[model samples]
Structures are given as structure tokens and as C-alpha cells.
Target: MRVHIILAAVFWCGFVDSRKIRGISSSYKRFYRERKSFLCIDGSKILPFEQVNDDYCDCEDGSDEPGTSACPRGRFYCTNLGFRPHYIPSSRVNDGICDCCDASDEYNSHAHCQNTCWNLGQRERAYVEGQMRTLDEGLRLKQQLIEEGVLLWREKQAQLRELQQVAEDLQIKLEEHRRRKNEADRLKEQTLKALEAGDSGLIRQNSTVTSVFQLLDSNKDGSITVDELQARVALIHDEERVLSEDEAVALLGGGHQMELTKFRHTLWDILTKGDSVKIKDTLGAPDSLGGEDPHLKAADRAAKWEATNLKKVEEAYDTVNMEISDLQKKLTIDYGTDWEFLFLNNQCYKLKVYEYTYTLCPFNQVTQKNTAGTEVSLGHFFCIVCQTLTRRTVCVLGGCGP
Candidate 1:
């Protein structure tokens, strides 16, 4: 009977042990499912707690079973009342040092950890609030600046409208002035055309006389002897003179006789008579009228016209320059000083005025000035290739002789 009792007791104990083992296995599987680290050796999903304290790394990230420290690089968070939550590495999770201000890293059942997390949490909250307050103040200042910018924009818009009105008025005046100038130009052009026509007629007449004279003087000897020339002169003067062999050769053709006679009459008549005469009065002396110097009078009239046009052009240019100056001033006021303006007006002016002939000197002088310890006032050099001024001394060295 006793033996039977012992056997029964042993069986019961074995059954209980088996049940406990099964329960542990079930719990491990449930935790593995929740954490998704099950079957880690074969790359299957299971719970984190199942592999938490396993000697071998089971999960790829090793985030399982925070209670039993396993993975060295894992993180754990401790909830501390009245204190900011803190995270510690898995290696420190069970180090028994109680590093967390709240001492929450130690399990509630553990005896060694103490509580100070509430004070740390309050301090952290206060620090964050202070930062928020500073940010709020800065935001308010930015808003004020934005308002000022808006007001400035409104004023600029008003100024732009005024400027536009001024521009329009100036444009209207310019158009009127242009119209007057154009009319004046047209009148001047007509006068010039009339003068050109008169001059052209005289030139044509002169050309005809020249052609006739060239035909008569076929040998192109330039001049006739006094005796031979007298014969031709006498033909116009109505006197007698002797002709020579040279004269006979020169007067080979007689077709120019009538034209020459007509030319003589026109010249003498214009010089002697002062009144305008009909074109048919070719046999009479010219009328010398009024003692007027036509050449001088025409030149004076042309000068007067040019002066008037120049004045008008100057006025137009002045108006344009004024507008440009005003626009430049407005731009400078709206934006800032323009570096390009300084560069063009100052630097370029200096380069143009002083640099033209400085390039003819020796390179040694240039180098001396460049390296001079004192404030050396070195002149600029002219670059023949680029047609600009430069300070570089070595450029174009040993080139063509100056």
C-alpha cells in the first residue's frame, strides 16, 4: 500500500511539472507573437519578451523581454511620475546601479531603487515652457516688423503713382517739342533742296563749257600762247587777233563756238547787272544787283539754322537727362547704393584718364610700384589688345616695339 502511495505521488508530481512546463512554453509563444520575434533562429516572427534574456540574440533588433537584459544595444523607457521619461540601454537595464532619476528602471518588486523621477520631470517641463516663452516673444517682434514693411510698401506704391504721372506729363511735352522740331527740320530740308537744285544747275552748265573747251584743245597742252589765246578772247570781245599753228590745232572742232559765246554773255551780265534776267538774254552783259554776297548770305543762313536745331536738340537732351537723374535717385532711395554706379563713374573714369599711356614704361618700374612698402600711387596700364586699362605689368611683355 505504501509503495502504491509513493508511485502515485511521483506520478502526480510529474504531471504538475509537465503542466508547469507547458504553461511556460505557452507564455513564451504568446509573448513571442506579441513582440514579433518568434523563431528568430529561422527568421520567423515571435514575441520580444521570449528572447529578452536569451543568451543568443533572437530578434533582428533584439527588443524583446525588457525584464531579462539580453541585447547590449537595446533601449528601455522608465515611466516616472512628475518626471520626464528616460531611456537607458539594455546593457544598463539590470546593472543594479539605478541610473534613472525615478529609479523606475528597477522593477517595482526590487528593493534597491529609490524614487526621484518626479522632481526631474517637473524641472524638464519648466525648461520647455521657458523656451516656448522666448519663441513667442520673437514671433511677436517679427509680426511688428512685417507690419512696418506693409506700411512702407503702401507709401512706395503712392510714390510710384506720382512718379508715373510726372513721367506722363513729361512725355506729352516731349512729343509736342518733337513735333515742332520735325516741322522745322522739314522746312530746313526744303530750303536745302532748293539751294542744291540751283547749285546743280550751275554745275551742269559749267560741265558743258568744260567739255567744249576740252574738245577745242585736243592736244591737252594746258595753255595757249598769248597770240593764239587772244584770238579766242577776241571772238567774245569782238576784236581782231592773229592765230598761230598751235591755235589752229587747238581749234580743230568748231561745234563749241555758240556755247562759248553764250557762257561769256552770262558771266559778264551777272557780274555787271544787279537784277535777275531772263534765260534768253544770252547775248547781253550780266546785271550786278544789290551788291549782295550770296555765298556769305547762304552760309550765314545755314549757320543760323544749325544753331536753332542744336538748341532744340540740347533742350530735348536736357529733359531726358533730368528724367534719368530723377529715376536714378529714386532707385538709390528705394534700394541701396549701387556698386555698379561707383564702378562705372569712378573706377572707369580713373582707368580711362590715367591708364592710356602708362603701359609704355618698363616692367621693373611696374613691379617696384606694386611691391613698394609705402602707399605708392601707381598709374594704370593700357591693354592694347582689349582696349582697356589694367594694372598687370607682365601682360604683353616682350611684344612688338612701342
Candidate 2:
């Protein structure tokens, strides 16, 4: 009795599983009823169930003959069990060539088709798995780069802040130094005018002569010696070389030194009227003014020192300003939406064409060099645009050619 029951269950399962209509996928099996009449798939007509796969055209829309090529526009399904299910044109059915991998299309033909769907499916699965692994690795690397880029961006911002602070400090110092220099100059001018106006015949000379005398007489011994002239001025002779000691003495009225009165009568006139001497007071010399009023001498020295300090401060301020400008420009660049491409900033790539080598500097410019070493700029990086269909981005270069 148990053996009979098992036999009956196996038969029933087989019958139920084999109830699918010919050339119809399992999803459409409900429409292919086992009853007497068959309704066209488009509901355009009703036909007898025997005409479903008959070798005769029945319905105008070819819906009643999907399993055969009876209708020119009909479609035949290939239930490729081990791979993908598909449909082929009805004209290709039983045409000698095996259009379906399972040989279902050539059911009544002599042509043979092999079941290669399983092998094709295996290869497709492996390809998809490889692509997934590659995508995972690419995403991981992208995340790492983005992190690194963020750190780099923060570092740059820190540098910018530090530079901005330095520039601000330098500006303040520059202003202070400028004020000190101006005050010193005003005091020195007032003192020199008072000394020149006094009846002390020691400096009964013009303001220009008096100023020249004070600069040259760094030791303030009431006279300017050859050593003092050489130390105080870069006396260019003949517009090409330094003036010799003899030349200095000749200009100083045939003596090695000249008092203020003789200097006015000789060197001052020559300096102002002739090109025999060029006196550029390169003033950074030590002075001990024993013959002049201590206050006046102190004022002159203070003015010279302040002027030198102001120059140094100006130079430092300029340097800081330039650095700030450069940092601002770098910070304003567009790295990426998430700063992902920041790692490529200032990085360069190269490619060689037939007769030229092209260099691409990210966020900078593109240039090409020929075999002869002549380089031409292609363009500068302008913007980036994403192509929707391609799902990729392209950089747009501008300002030159392309």
C-alpha cells in the first residue's frame, strides 16, 4: 500500500509541473487555461485551444500562435532554464539555425542546438562578482583620499590664518616705525635750521652745504678727512670707479682734509655744479660728534636710525602681504564637492602623442611640448561638468586654446 501511495504522489507532481503551455513562460501560464476556448493575449479574439501552436495563422495580432511561426509577426519564448529567459522572432523558429540555446526553437527541425546557457551564466556571474569587488576597492580608496584631502585643507587653512596674523602684526609695526621716522625727521630738520641760524659762525653755510658737512664729518672734528669721505659716501669717479684718495684730496682743495668753510668753497661747489664727484651718503657709520651740540647730533643719529628701521619694516610688511595674497588665491580654488580631488592639486600627469608630450597639472594648466622642446599652453583649468548619460565628469579648460 505504501509503494502504491508513493507512485501516485510522483505521478500527480509530474502532471502538475508539466501543465505549462508551450513557448509560454511560467508567469503567463495562468492565461493559457486548460479549458476549451483560448482568448488571444490582446483580447482581440477567441479561438479553440487546439489552434495555440498550430502551423496556421489565426489571430491578426499574432497572439494566438506564439509557439509557432504561423504568423509573420509572432514571438516565440525561449525558456532557457539555466540562464535567462528570452524571446525570439517567430520567423527564426525552426529555420534550421538554432536561435534558442535549449533547442526549443528547432523542435521540429533537423538543426541541433547545444545547452550552453549554464556555462554562459557562470561566466556572467564571475564577471559581475569581479566588477563588484573592483567597485568596493575603488570606493574604499576614494574615502581614504577624501579624508587625506580634508586634513590637507585644514592644514592650509591653518597656515592662512597664521599668515594673516603675521601680516596684521607687521602692518602695525610698519605704521609705528613710519610714525617714529617722521617724528625723527621733523626734529632733525628743526634742530639743523636752528643751528644754521645761530650766530655761531661754525656753520655759516647754506643748508645743503651744512647737511653735506654734517654727514661727511661723522667724527665731528670740524673737518672732513679722506677716510671720513670714503666711509661716509660712495664717491663714484668718472661714473665707473670709486674715487682714489688723491682724487678725494684734489676735490678737497689739495689737502687730505677740509674744514667746513673750505668745503663750502671747494667740494660743495664741485658736487653741486660739476660731475667731478658724486657723493651718495651711504650713512650707516658710527659717529662721535665732539664739536657739535650734543642734542643736534643725537637728533641726526636718531633720524638716520629710524629711517633704516622703517625701510626694514616696509620690506617685511610687503613680504607678508604677498604671502597672504598667494594663500588667499590657493584657498579660493574649487577642489571638489567633497574635496575628493584635492589630492590632485598641484599634481601633474603626462601623456605622449605622436610628436608631442602633453602635461596636465591639476587645477593649473595644460601644456604640450614638441620633439624640438617648444612648449605651448593648451589652456587653464576652468570648470568641471558631469555628463549624465556617461555618468562621468570632464574638466573644462579656458583662457587659451584647448
- Per-model TM against the reference: 0.37, 0.66
lDDT of each: 0.43, 0.73
Best of the candidates, TM-score: 2
Cα lDDT tens digits, model 1, 1-402, are 999999999999975543221101222444433333344433455554344444445566554434335666555566555775556775666567786676655543354877876677678888989999999998786666566555554564676666576667666766654554454444445445545666534423433333323222223343333332323332222223344445433443322222345434443244224342211111223212224433223223333444554476567657656765655443332121222122121122112223232212321222122223333334322234223334343444222223
lDDT by residue (267-338, candidate 2, tens digit) is 766654434444543454323333355336655766786787789889988988888887777777777767
The reply for model 2, stretches above 4 Å from the true place, is 1-20, 199-285, 291-297, 383-402
